[model samples]
Target chain A: MDFVQLKKNCKKDASAFPGYRLALLGDCATQHLAMALKGAAYEEGIALSVFDADYNQLDAQTLDPSSELYEGKPQGVVLCLCTEKLYEAFTLSSDRAGFADATFRKIKGYWDRINAHLSVSILQFTFVERDDRVFGNYALKEETSFYYQVKKLNLLIAEGTRLVKNVYPVDVDSLERRLGRDKFSDPKLYAIAKMPFSLEALPLVAFETVGIVKALMGRFKKCVVLDLDNTLWGGVIGDDGMEGIQIGELGTGHAFTELQRWLKELKNRGIILCVCSKNNENTAKEPFEKHPEMILRLDDISLFVANWHDKASNIRYIQKTINIGMDSIVFLDDNPFERNLVKQTVEGITVPDLPEDPADYLPYLQSLNLFETTSYSENDRDRTKQYQAEIGRILLEQSFESFDDYLKGLDMVAEAKSFDPFHYPRIAQLTQRSNQFNLRTVRYTEAEIEKIAGDERYLTLYFTLKDKFGDHGLISVVILEKRERELFVHEWLMSCRVLKRGMEEFIVNKMIETAKEYGYASVVGEYIKTPKNAMVETIYAKLGFTDRGDHTFVADCATFQPNKTFIKE
Target chain B: MERNEILEKLNEIFRDVFDDDSITVTEETTSSDIEDWDSLTHITLISEVEDEFDIKFAMKEVVGMKNVGEMVDIIEREA
Candidate 1:
């Protein structure tokens, strides 16, 4: 879809709740990135409104600190950082089409300022290798410098992002990968064309970058479900038997083992791994428990169900157990029948096309990028062990049949911490991906979240859950913006794994207490209807908040009753 | 290849770029003669012609490619 069609679709699709308002800022040089962003927004279910400005008509003053451009509310704003504009901004005289360095600085400065207000801002780094082979006949070394300048601009964008929270660098290198090196050598062709790529590249870049923006701002899937047999290994475990199955060194067997190692790595990246296999429970358990070659032990699986059940039904069982939306679950199967069946049966579960070759499995699964993240920290590496601990927690809960009994047996300990510098990245990620239990569902980029927290007008809260099992890491976030005496709950979402565990009670209770401490009259909640968030339609009502129109829920802080059972820290 | 043969090869590049099978070629045929000869396609067509003929034209020569005649003359000189 083009930018216009994608925007229209995103506005109409009920799944992309908390729609985005976008501003496309650039001259001719940046138009393709704008187009690419539009395509990406459509794919991501984000409502985008684009305003393309004429390069020659832009006024430096408007993009300055005191201008209204920064004042306009947009979910995300994209800027083109090409050398053509940079050269013009540096050298062109005002009458003929030149601006002072101050103007360019102001442009960059204003974007930083806007990022301080917006939820997400994507900056397209300057692309080298434009079709300039003949236009300005520079030597080979000069062309190398031109390419070096793009890298330098990318660094500038990266450093500039530190000043604004949700500022993200779109990899121009990856964007240019579509354009082969030969396209740059022909002077007859390259001289007249300023843009490097074909018309096809524009929509694609816009679409993919917008996806990056949404991923930075919106919610991602919470759980990754695996099918055994050919998916996790080279051949069917039931057919090959434990001894014959591929899980060791050399050939196709090593491929399956490598895929398992990758999945284990993914688990470390916080994608919960659940096994839905059709095998004799005893038969499947043999490799997991006894085989030394097994890369994924029983402890590796967050939820394991081995039976003859339909794969989709088994996935639903796990989803219900976790209390997460089907949209947040990614199912992988080597069998096309099982994959097609789940795709037909489950409306929202993402089942990527399975590869036939065992060697292709690792790349195919990795390419799905179920746990794609922009920023990586040391703590993310330990996500698997935490989920294993959660599985242990689930097993511990089975000791009691009743809900209250389960709560009592763990001697539940909940720690509530306000947002700090350390938890910023995790909090930003949770806000982007947590769906079913999200109230309001306002997505935030890292820069936007930082700005929101820095501003006195907004209060952001992050909750780290650790029951008797262990720490669930930073799994939940609540964003509130001040409106006179009221704190408007702009964004509230919790990782679905922590759902039904009374962790929501712990967080909401904290919000109520916080409202009282801050002297706010009422703590308002919102339940914006989204295709994936139907589960949270009654979350506010269950928490004793009065429903208002347009999915807003309200409750007075004075009369709020805290669920006394959740042990607070 | 002589000038006539080079022009014939160049004509093929033009036909492919414009996606027109029945396009007539002369020294005076400009991009305006056929559709799909926008800026991007112009680059593609010229690049293909240069590769086929093993000769590169200057940027001024490509930009000055108003008619088929100018394109043929540039190719003739370069080749």
Candidate 2:
């Protein structure tokens, strides 16, 4: 969207939508940027209430205890320290050699103080690279030059913030490089109004900022639903056969190769890759199985759905089998008719407008930033194998006569243990990403998880499951707070991939066992209703806990019978 | 473009930017005549006019344009 359209969106009434409070702290004037942020958020069904700080008050607002920044109680704080202001500081500094480190120290102090007051996510804008070019080409070798310092400062911001779990660098430096410095900044506008970015660049910056907010709020794409023919490679796989279809590093085939390489990287990073195609099942499997030049093999895909039905129905089936929200899936198809059909049918799925030329596919997709994740762990690399095992279990279930028989035949094993420092990252990620099976959904960062692991008042458990097929790594998390006479289930969530496999029964039995061992008379569980968590609304009642009629369920530890499950703990 | 033609186009831009259909601009019309026009909207108005005319307004013209007639003069000269 352009500046005018985004500005007009600011006037629309967004009172009914979900609201996100954000405090915008910038050294430059931020009225226009605030408007653009709200406008961009409105387009995504988020009513962003921005607390725009006063002009050049970054120090005053962040340092003071009773400042408006604290009073606003924002869920997020955005810090924009522009390159123009940084250049002025560089020019006035007495010691240019230590400029980057000193500036980074001051910025880190702001993050530390704000985090001490409130546990809110800090979205910091990296310094955009700008040079006066006084030393020309020799500036690259000069550590004291403004250009060199700015580059080093950007790197320092990235590396320094890695130690803090709540601080997220917005990478505005990359945005400037992509848009070109001239297009991103206009000196005349900066001189007139103290605004750093041009009107045209404001919307892009606003979108990028809101993207991080969306991910932090537990809204992000988790899977990529792909089309095989023409979309993944050149020509139809059915007509061209496995050998004739283009993929590798020759001619237009190189374009598809690059796209597949990127998709492979995404799969390795925990984004589930699924296939929904309109070709024959065998024909679609042939290319992935037999083609020598194919970058994506049959093992890379989690759920492969190749049928003769319309793509919209096929995609819905894929969504149902994977047990993720339709909004978390991105559908890519080369045909406009298929794209429009799926776009109109699916309510929340993202279907990008694939360009006509095959070569423009990867570049266009990269610019959209379809995948934005807040947390990652080493366990993410094993996600594809877990899903593939799930598919294997599903196929095995079809041959069984009864559901109980299928569960017992799988030979499932589970391990439950208290929270360790090693599993904290994966536990926190499950809290942020799992929405369907979550009860009283409370998102915690890695730091909060670490605190909970050390605190005596809270009891934490992380569960892992494996069957005869493969291992589902660190699938569930339960955090219980000890009360006067009972244990309160503060947070309980599980990965949807492990649903309907007697995992909930296994977890509840473990919870009561722990409470009995601790000498608590009763265990209480609460179910908070959300739009996506209705699947688990009556879960406690179904698990034999007496409903207390006020969203709380009670189980007497003395009389509680251990739930019968197929899994051995 | 004729002077009257420029005025007619400016009237459309003014109505669109201010979200009003009845706004009619002439040589005497300025920021004071419009209820929503301020320093913030003034920059937006300048940007809209530049985009519509496919011309770049000088920094002076952006901040110092006295009336709708002055805006039209720049558009006429640049167009």
Candidate 3:
């Protein structure tokens, strides 16, 4: 999205957009950045309100809590403090190392000030090196060189933000390096308008900022649903019959093998992989099951929906089976018609325009950056097994006469434990990403988790469920806020990956048990309604709690009994 | 292409870039004339015109061109 176009789109009445106030704080000319971002936000389908600070007023706006930024109360704040200004100060001052340390302190001070005042997330740009060959290549070797100083400064900013709550760095120097200094900076334009970056680099900056914004909004592709045939390999599975399809480390097959390798690695990172192919079910299974060089096996796929049905319906089936929103999926098919059809039918399913040549597929997908995320943990690796086990649990349900019988047969063991640092990363991730099974959705960072765990007023319970088939690692979290003799369920959320295993009943039993252990009379559960979590809307009522309206339910420990489950702690 | 023909093409490109179908360009037209035409859009406009006309803009032409007429002159001369 270009600035002129954004300026035009900004003219449109944005009253209908779910408005998000974004505070853009900077020292140099950033009106264009703000304007360009408005257009970029429009492109990302985000309704943005840009609250930009005045010329060279970075310190004033951040340091002073009474500034317009705080008054506006924006959802996100982007700091674009110009490092070029440091050159003037550095050139005049003799204490180079001291200057660097002071600059680092000042930058961190701004971050601390923002953290002090607001609960909003910060997007800060790290310093880009301004080349001064006065020290030559030796300048890079010495700490006093502007080159070495900038590197140290950027490193300090990065290291400081690591594991710190809510602060994220956007590397402007990396962008400058990638685009090359000449392309990234137009001296003529900078002299004319005080615009630090050239107009060409504006779109890149805008998109990166928007990407982070979208991820924060919990609106990014969660799964990459793939299509078989010419997409995954060099020929049709129906025609090639597993033997003839080209997919190996050799010859023309190298490209397809490379594609499969990328997909497999993505699956390892917990991006759910589902297959929607038009080939016969058996034919589709043959490649995954029998092909010697196939990188993705049947086990790698969460759901394989292969039929003569339209691609869109298969995609819908995958969504229904996995129980994730359409926006969270990216469907890849080499055929343009199928891609377009799926894109049209399912409003938000990301269908990338694949190139005619299979070699170009990986590069194109990389450019899309379809699966950007804020954090990851060891528990992410267990995601594939968790989803795959859901299919098993669903299949086993058919043989059992009752839901209770299904639960009894699974030998489900629920390991009730408190929030441990080892499991805290995954615990925090669940609070952020688990939308469907979430009730009273309250997102938290690791720091907040630590505080909540240590607080006497709060009881944090995490559960890891293991059935006869596999272990669901840390799938459920319950936060109870103690109120005198009573307890309030602050957050109640479980992973859909562990659904239909009588986990809800088991969780309630544990909550009631915990309440009794803590000498509380009754424990209340909240069922806050979000569009994605309707599946769990009646959970509290179903578990024998009285619905007191407004999504609140209460149950007394006197009447509660531990629900029978094959799962044991 | 005649200057009028070049202008017509430029107007179409403008409409596409701005996502407004009602846009038209004349010799006196400047970035200020269109609500969406600013520094960001100016680069986009120049790139699109370059793509459409199969030519590259000199840095001088990119910054120096003031209106649709000057753009047409450069495009015509280059083409």
> DockQ: which candidate is best?
2
CAPRI verdict (incorrect, acceptable, medium, high) for model 2: acceptable
Q: Residues A83-122, candidate 3, lDDT per residue (tens digit)?
A: 6676777788798877778787887888788888888888
When 1 and 2 are scored with lDDT, the better candidate is: 2
What proportion of the true contacts does each candidate reproduce? 0.38, 0.23, 0.08
Best by lDDT: 2
In model 1, the number of clashes is 22
Between 1 and 3, whose DockQ is larger? 1
lDDT (0 to 1) per candidate: 0.67, 0.91, 0.83
What are the per-residue Cα lDDT tens digits for candidate 2 across A274-294?
A: 999988999999988988888
DockQ of each: 0.22, 0.41, 0.19
> How would you order the candidates by TM-score, starting with the best?
2, 3, 1
Per-residue error at A565 for model 2, in Å? 8.0
lDDT of 1: 0.67
lDDT of 3 by residue, B1-79 (tens): 8988888898899898887888878999998889978875676677668768987778788888988899999999998
